[model samples]
Target: MASIGYFLSCEQFGPKELIDQAKRAEAAGFEKLWISDHFHPWNDEQGQSPFVWGVIGALSEATSLPVTTAVTCPTFRIHPAITAQAAATAACQLDGRFVLGVGSGEALNEHVLADPWPSVGVRLEMLEEAIDVIRLLHRGEEVSHHGTYYEVQDARIYTLPAEPVPIYVSGFGPQATRLAGRIGDGYVTTIPDADLIGVFKESGGADKPVQAGTKVCWDRDAERALDIAHRTWGNQGLPGQLAQTLPRPRDFMDAQALVPRESTARAVACGDDVDAQVAQVRAYLDAGVDEVYVSQMGDDVEGFFAAWDEDVLPALR
Candidate 1:
């Protein structure tokens, strides 16, 4: 059976709100939590971004739900060695109920350090090496390595959970999917693409969990919900590598303007129809996903949670 979880949008909410949401989600029958890690919101209209690790720290005190970074980029904005320490601490705090979801990262967060953004090929190579560095540190041994993109000198994570933290890799395409299979303890994606999961399982990821997530807006007013969805997440419909390559939130806002509201509507399930919400989540479960997470795109998070708990989740269960 597939597990269902709540996706906390750090890009759209502050730390307190996310912690509160996690507590509510656990109370509402959500089995796990996926919190996004970002330095900035997608656009100013969405308007909030908090340091994800801090929020996770607060979440550890507030709730017992298993948590994972929907994805963190240890390749650029932060060094892999440091991420290893943070993940180790988080695992200890959560009593090993933590997974580090990592990816190649986006230019919007990575370019802040003024490092020239490398091509996707280089980014992927860096991600592979970064994962290696993190795993080494997790073993609680001092590690020193000089790699093509990163260098670490005698780094070790002193605090760790009894078990090594499970690392899940996120991908949007075939190459990344293959990399996730070869290196990841699990796999994550926003889209419910069965073919991608098939490739991951076939490419040395057999028996590993396949995780997927999506967003929706639930309101009595369908048009209002649609508007909120479009405003907050229109970029979800942007095609190609635009989501990754764009260097600023404004670039995303500008590009998202061209994305038709109709497209966003189709991509995000809107309004308070419990069946619709259930169907959106069902798509991911049917796609062979072992875990499914859902995020609400607007301010009516309480309403969304209530609907899911009282109506949607029962059907899914």
Candidate 2:
């Protein structure tokens, strides 16, 4: 059976609320935690974006559950060397229960510093080099490297964990998936596509762990839940590279207008129906995922956890 975890949405809730949710999730039987790393929320409606490293530090003291960044873009917004140091410190704080999940970041976050957002191929190349830099620095040795995409001079993370942190790569498409399989300690994605999992395994990720995340709104009023889902996360329904290229929350607000409410209704599981919630997560586990993390998309955090504790989690287990 796959492990079930809670996804702490830094995009939706503030740091204190996230910490509270982390504790609630642990008490509610979640086996682990997945927290998003973002400089900005996809849209202003989502409303919050805390520095994930600081939240992770509080989480280290708040909950005993393992924590993984659902995805961080170490290539552009921050240098991979700095990311390596932050991740190392987080691992030590979490008592070795940290996973640095990285990806080719979106323009919304990466472009904030005025860097040009490159094409997918170039971004992937940068990600590959960034991963190499991170791994080299994680070795606890003074390292100086002038790579094609990055440079580091005599950098060493003094506050290292007993073991180097595991770096999981996030992939939403075939090329990234192949790269993740070839180099990642594990794979991270949102879709529960079995074919993609097969591609990962065949690309040298055989027997490695696969983690996935999904969103749901657990409410008594299904229509209200759907409304919240559509209003807050309609950007999720946008197809293609719009998510990658859109540089601002207002841009997303405009692009997400193209996404119909019906699409969010289909993409996100809504209502207090335990069966629907279980099925949503089961799809990932059925796809050979080793861990499935669920994020609540409504304001009824207490109700969501209550339902998960009483019904959804039990059924899945």
Candidate 3:
């Protein structure tokens, strides 16, 4: 059976709240955890963006469930070598139960240092080079790389898990999906497109794990749940490329205004309907996703967990 995990939204909750959610997820019988790695929330209304690495440290002590960064950008903001070190440390802390999920990244977080945001092609090229550098350093031998996009000189990770960390590459389109298949240890994406999963497998990702995530709003009041989903995560309804191209939360907020309430209604499963929640997750599983991580968008986390424990998880399993 495919695994069902909880997604801890760093973009929506602070560090302490995330750790608490981790523990709650484990207690509620969620098999694993996926956490967002973001420098900023998509918008101020979503409200929080804690540094992911520090929160991962606390999660290591708080929950035994495996953890994966839904995706991290090693191409910009932070060098691949530094990312390798951080991933290694996290793997050790989790006792080899961690996966480093990487992506080409968005301008939202990458633009913070005032660096130019390259085009999609250039970003993917840089991401490929970054992964190469990270893998070399993870070998525990001094690596001096002078690639077109990055230069790592005599860098070696001193602390590492018994095994090298598994790197899962995130891809949303055909080009990036093929690249993920060619180089990634596994694949990560949010959409449940069976065609893309086929593309990944044919491009050499066969036998590797494929992970995806989605969000839901679980509340007793169905209408109120939809309202919260629209307000807090309406960014999900933004059209193509806007999410990757927009550089600031305000820009996203501005674009978010165009997202109709109906779009969010179609995108997210809301309310206390057990059948609705089960079917939403089953959509990903039917699309060949090996693991599906679900995030609750409402504030009533305890209610969400109780519903999952009593009705949703049992039905899915």
Model 2 lDDT tens row, 291-311: 999999999999999999999
Tens digits of per-residue lDDT for model 1, 111-226? 99998888888899999999999999899998899888889898877899999999999989999999999999999999889999999999889989988879989998999999
Which of the predicted structures, 1 or 2, would earn the higher lDDT when compared with the native? Answer: 2
Per-residue accuracy of model 3 over 105-139 as CA lDDT, tens digit each: 99998999998998889999999999999899989
Question: How much lDDT does candidate 2 score?
Answer: 0.94
lDDT of 1 at 221: 90
Which portions of model 2 show Cα errors greater than 4 Å? Answer: none
C-alpha lDDT (0 to 100) for residue 186 of candidate 3:
95
The number of clashing residue pairs in model 3 is: 0
In model 3, which regions exceed 4 Å deviation? none
True-structure RMSD for candidate 1: 0.7
Model 2 TM-score relative to the real fold:
0.99
